[model samples]
Target chain A: AQSVTQPDIHITVSEGASLELRCNYSYGATPYLFWYVQSPGQGLQLLLKYFSGDTLVQGIKGFEAEFKRSQSTFNLRKPSVHWSDAAEYFCAVGRGSNYKLTFGKGTLLTVNP
Target chain B: DVKVTQSSRYLVKRTGEKVFLECVQDMDHENMFWYRQDPGLGLRLIYFSYDVKMKEKGDIPEGYSVSREKKERFSLILESASTNQTSMYLCASSSHDRLIPYEQYFGPGTRLTVT
Candidate 1:
């Protein structure tokens, strides 16, 4: 079955440090991948997506993800992190023209000052 | 901005009682979805509608039903509210761009509790 996996259940980083949240997928063909962030008591917000893109895709809130077909991975990264970036992040995968997002368990990011 | 709204922010329902959760989207998106969010399991799709009156069962559709008589409104129904069904319910809508791909705009979510 097609699925998205974020191996890290929790991660902590200094406010200004570089951040990376790993995501891997298992799909039959080229898949559409996405990253969403959810704050406490709020709904999931779209961060970035990759679908036939230029491998590296930029998204809102100073976030970007690299889509590597060989590794079957689309990892989210940020050159610098902010205190506001502390939230739960989810990795999702979809196929075909449909937009059904299959999401991972998510990674809780804690940014320390 | 894409806006999706759920009728209730919090709800308390009794077990074995019929419950309805309403969702509305201002954007004329062709797709609408209902999902339940849990701590470790992430978000599970309950049902989705591609067009008015066109509904499809999602991965976890049992114990839930959906209504889409209108394009902008989708409703999730619980035939008999149960404690197991209590969770954060989310509503989302998206438009087809066929270009850079589309994003599903989510509502604030309704946290439901069953007694």
Candidate 2:
């Protein structure tokens, strides 16, 4: 069974500061990792994904994630976050032919001015 | 761009009442999914359909049923709405093209409150 763990439950970052959200996965095979963001009253929007090739994958809205195979982790990062970047972030691992996803508990990001 | 739409943004339902949640996708996606989001729990898959009229149970599908009568529409049914079922319900669709990894596109979500 594939599983995802997001260590941070909540994080507050000063506006324009760099941000990093930690994610770890447990999967037997090569992992398919994804990052998603959700606003207060909206559904999830895919930020980025990693299937193969390069370890560093770029996503929408100036987001990027690096997949560390040895550590079994895919952590999201942004060089400079804005107030609008405050949202709930989720990390997921996909498996099976249908590409079923197992998601983490999510990290709530709060950006301060 | 792929667009997925759900029936409602918020719904209030009584316990024991049968609840129906509708979802539609515009990109002719072959896969549709239902998931519930709760505080402290990110998302739990309830059901999914790969093709028209074909459904599969997900990790948490005990109290839910689903129907995919057409390729563009997927409906999630709650046999008897309960207080525990009060949560944000999300619908998503993705292509089954083997060349791609099937990244999902989600709807705005419906916050269902069962009283």
Best by DockQ: 2
Give the Cα error of residue B48 in candidate 1, in Å.
0.8
Off-target runs (Cα >4 Å) in candidate 2 are none
lDDT (tens digit, per residue) of candidate 1 on A6-113:
999999999999999999999998888899999988888999888784999999999999999999999999999999999999998875567777889999999999
List the global CA lDDT of all models. 0.91, 0.94
Go through the candidates in order and give each one's DockQ: 0.68, 0.79
Interface RMSD of 1: 1.3
Error of 2 at B47 (Å): 0.5
Model 2, C-alpha of B5: deviation from truth (Å) = 0.1
**How displaced is residue A78 in candidate 2, in Å?**
0.4
The C-alpha stretches of model 1 lying farther than 4 A from their native spots are: B100-102
Most TM-score-accurate candidate: 2
Model 2 per-residue lDDT tens digits across residues A24-47: 999999888899999999999999
- Candidate 1's DockQ is 0.68
Instruction: Summing lDDT over every window of 10 consecutive residues in candidate 1 chain B, give the lowest-scoring window.
Output: B94-103
Model 2: DockQ vs. true structure: 0.79
For candidate 2, write residues B1-80 as lDDT tens digits. 77899999999999999999999999988989999999998899999899999999998999999999899999999999
